[model samples]
Target: MSVLPDPGATRAVLIGTSHYDHLESLPAVSNNLTALAEALTGPTSWTLPQEHCTILSNPTTAEMTMAAVRAAAEQARDTVLIYFAGHGLVDPEGDLYLAMPQSKQRRVETGLPYRWIRQALLNGRADRCVVVLDCCYSGLALGTMGGPSDLADQAAVEGTFLLAAAAETRQALAPPDETCTAFTGELLDTLQTGIPNGPELIDFGALYRHLRIRLAAKGRPDPQARDRNTGARLALGRNLACLPTTATTPSADGEPATARSWPSPSGIRTVRGFFKSLADVRVTSGLTHQMVSQRSGGRISPGTVSRLLNRESLPKTWHTTAAFLSACGVPDQQVAEWYAVWTRLLTDTTTDAAPHTVPHPRQHQKPTTLQRLTGRLSRRNGRSRDHRSGSS
Candidate 1:
């Protein structure tokens, strides 16, 4: 028996976090959070009311996440959906848990327990609760806690379904490119345009199959579904006959008929805001200084890092600027978009291929110590080659 309720009457609380104080994290989590929120709230004309959806993001901390989960569960009437995208680890006791900013990988015992989440669902007022865990080692928490058979039995009585990104021993892949996590990206892609409505309801079995196929297409490890209750299933309920199958098409005028576009100023602000957000994350993660030195191969100085962060100096070459952004995990598309917008503002045309050229006040000045050392090494290598050639 599964613990999912009538899907049509469900209220969702989607949360995504990516930045871990320690661990290899991706900016994709933040992007996925934004995308998921849009999918739920956007005027895609899903059969459900938009007012029932709630979304949250906490890339740096888990304190807010706990509060959001509790509040959503309390407020939910029929069904509660919780989606998490971040890091997961196990404690010495073999208990699985999600990692927080202050989480100590070594002392995993202190991390937030996965059982806490289970207990939340068990105690929550909602009739059906769905948990989507999109993180590496996610299955460890659910798999070690109990077998799918036990969960199915519980769900038959209480209604609960857990979807894990991978098996206990496998690792889930991050976004292949600039998209969200491979699993989440596919989920959204399917939800928006794939599923159709009517007599043929998108069953849990079908949905999982769709998600699995999409993830596998991206070369990701397949996700496993655990159904604990046999009689439990997701239904649209009375208020909603079926999840809206019609895709929202654009108007003839090239404007979204239902979806609202950000105002020009707001769009510009969002672009700039994203950059500032990345900068802030870099500082908090201590990756800014580390990235500059790492990409420069010890050529960049701490003082140069200070200047770049303070905006007192910019990278003199496109390669350096791109590398710096890459180190901070800013997607190339986003950088290109920003650059395109800037070019349009200056030239009144959106299409431009001219490369960005940095203007230095003292272009003829001698190269810095780092450049001089590299130049000398190059000359020495050339002379050695010449001598070798003459001897030969």
Candidate 2:
């Protein structure tokens, strides 16, 4: 039988969360989301458009996530990609559901249903939809959902693919030094640097094997990992890079996609400037400062706060950026504005604004007792530990 091919246009939604108010899981989920967002949308060797993807971190509920998924599916043209990194729990029936930010550990039944995600894929119009889940015990729940025969049947009827971190009984880890869960991090590393060509041209089976070998090396072999890993393997009947029959020639409405490249120095300065403004607002508006600091998990020191406002330093790493943004409760739209401004500063040469001079760190304010306590707790938890399958 002739196999159907993936459609040309692609849209994606990425959701990540770690700190659940009552879920008892630490704040590792958001880290994976931020990392995946940066890898997928950042100006890397392989580029996916910033506009085409939406990211939600520390969502209030599974319903909220499902809403986002529905919206993305509605917007997609040919393909839809959904990635989630968070806690996974099973019910008495052994069905799996991803835990949301407001999830209660004791009230596991309230979590979002995995079937909802599956249904979303089955209903979407896209020729193909891929879902990547990263969480402990994620595989267990995912394993019962369906198999290759079902997937083949589904693909024949409505195209969809599912990738899970590990088997139902196995746990997926988030290593301390790493930004993403082991499965996601390795998968992205392979996708970004390992793929000879981008997704369109890459061999799905080879990619699956590569991911399996990488995960096995980590020593936490997921039981369902092998089955799902191989069963999900796909080979596009035709070259994905080639345009579809329905694809039109370049026109005003259908211009050839091009990446807006930026110079290193300009991009850095713009990012610094934007964060500096945010810091200034935080310092000037006590309410903003309190809100931002509280949201960030109380990790911001008075000195660090001062430095950030003064534009003396911003978080050097993406993790820090994620934390700061999380703490500040910066909305995605605002972040999108910052991204636009930064991109403009990098690409627009007509505006030759000089870099602002950074002020010295404020001297009077001391680290609050709450800050100290949270810092101690965070450290005691070994904040730098990466969450991997094998790592406790």
Q: Score each candidate by Cα lDDT.
A: 0.52, 0.52
Q: Mind giving the per-residue lDDT tens digits that candidate 2 earns over 100-195?
A: 766654355567767787788777766557677665432222212111212222212235556566553334455656655567677667755554
Q: For model 1, what is the error of residue 218's alpha carbon versus the real structure, in angstroms, after optimal superposition?
A: 3.9
lDDT string, candidate 1, 199-242, tens digits:
22333555677667777777666766665553125421111233
- State the lDDT at 271 in candidate 1: 24
Q: Please list the residue runs of candidate 1 whose C-alpha ends up more than 4 Å from where it truly belongs after superposition.
A: 1-9, 43-52, 59-63, 138-158, 195-199, 230-232, 235-392
Instruction: Provide TM-scores for the models.
Output: 0.50, 0.49
TM-score, cand. 2 vs. native:
0.49
Deviation (Å) of 302 in candidate 1: 67
TM-score of 1: 0.50
